[model samples]
Target: MSKKVAVLVAGSWGTALASVLAANELDVVMWTRSEEQATEINTQHTNTRYLPGAELSPRIRATSDMEAAVADAAAVLIVAPSSAMRAVTHQFKPFYTPDMLIIHATKGFETESLKRMSTVISEELECEEGQIVVLSGPSHAEEVVKRCPTTVVVASLDKTSAEAVQGLFMNAYFRVYTNRDMLGVELAGAFKNIIALGAGMSDGLQFGDNAKAALLTRGLAEITRIGVEMGANPLTFSGLAGIGDLVVTATSQHSRNWRAGSMLGQGQKLDDVLQSMGMVVEGIRTTQAAYFISQKYGVQMPIADQLYHVLFQNRQPRDAVEALMGRDPKTEMEVMKLETWEQWHS
Candidate 1:
């Protein structure tokens, strides 16, 4: 029999990834909270709410029972929303085996604890931090399901674990790269959502391409600065998980963070915008966590600062833009201090 893989949750990203695993000829069992969704995938092979018109593979099956979904599986992929990651992992703990390849594709931090998804999962699963692999990058589920050629990176402190995940998900349409800098990969993936939200807000406010370009560039510097402070490799920010994910999330119509930001920029209240989207806007919650993270690490994240004000403090989006533009002048490469630059090059 072929190796079986379990995907927790049937969200768009999860479903899309399950399709990839099924395409790679692995038997995929997805665990969902909704029995309706499980039946839809098993019967109709459609998840209209998430994937819309895309038809899932016959090899992909879903169940509401966590034990059934993970029983005898070779690997289990946790794709629950960051907010629900802890609960979802706890639910699967009874069924998880140490030898199973554990991987997660969720992006965002625990708002209260400000823990990355991997940290939260490792704590709940009682596994070594290095054993958990994080898969992230610029890939969008809509495109990935349609086989539009998506590239993503999987990172783990253990090279063998990362490579195992890469092998499990790699195929013609979906490409996976392995990175050992798991901290950098997870940080870049989570932080980029904040910038993407800002980008969408800029466009919604009619700031045009130039403003968006500046935001992307400066936003990246802010990300790199804070990431380095938190002990991530600076170069990781320039790779697939950083700049690559940033561009896609900031610009793509499929991006929930960008859409939420656009709505906010158009003068819609946060509550109303979220109600209309009906999806977990990871960036909004991430912005909250990033704000506290910046403070904890004593890093200057001007863009995130302004965004927090706009988002929570009810500062007008236009006024926030003006505030960002009107900050006291400083050198462009301030984020890369002289000492840090030399150390990086050396």
Candidate 2:
């Protein structure tokens, strides 16, 4: 018999994972905060609001009761937004154990605490390092649910923990790679959202691909700078969790980050943009967290700073883009190498 796996959060990603697990012929329970969503998944076998046309597996069930969903599961995947991770973890912690693998699909640090999703999970679940794992990459929930080819990374200090999840999710169309650089993978996942927002804003402004390319590249530099200072491996930024994820999120129409930024670029207010998107644009809040983290570490994240201004300080997106273009050019690789050296020391 296949082991039970519970996926918290019945959002697109969570539902997609549950669909995958059920397709794998594993018993899957999806925990939804909403009774209506739970009923849809349990009775209709479709998440009508989020994933419109996809037919979910009959083996997949949904529930409003967290305990019922998580109780029999050998592994628990938490897919809540970063903003809600702490409170959600607090609620689940009492039932957690070191024997079960805890996987976090949420990315980004807390704006106030600057704690990574893994850190928050560790504290809440009181799990050892080996028990915590992070799953991330360019894979969108919508595409994955459709069984499209997608690749992602499972990052953990423990190779066993990483491989365990890699085994769980690897199938015909989905490939999972393992990486020891948990910090890098996690940081890359969080920081890419900020850059994706910039990419969307650029696209919204009708800036050419040249401008979009520059934003994507420079945004990577800033992410690497802060990540290295925080002890993440520099090479991880060149991997799937970094560049690959950035490309997909920044460019895809399905990305809430891109949509939010596009609306902002078109002169819509932040609150209005968020309301229209209906889902949490993690990058907006994550940009605030990344900005504060950079300041605390004394790392110069120019793109993040510019994004912060655009999002909160009322700076125009075009003005920010122009400011970036007008900056004096220096040897770009020099900064990249410096960030690498900082990681070695950190």
- Candidate that would win on TM-score: 1
What lDDT would each prediction earn against the true structure? 0.94, 0.87
Off by over 4 Å in 2: 337-346
Evaluate residue 215 in candidate 2 and report its C-alpha lDDT on the 0 to 100 scale: 88
For model 1 the TM-score comes to 0.98
Residue pairs in collision within model 2 = none
Name the top lDDT candidate.
1
- Encode model 2's per-residue lDDT on 1-346: one tens digit a residue: 2399989888888888888778777889988889999998888999988888989999999999888888868899999888888888888877776677789888778877988988888888877755789999998889999999999999999998899889898899889999999999999999999999998998888887998898898889889878888888888999999999999999999898988888888888888898878888899989999889988988888888889999999999889988887888867874455646864668
lDDT per residue for candidate 1 within 12-62, as digits (tens), equals: 999999999999999999999899999999999999999999999999999
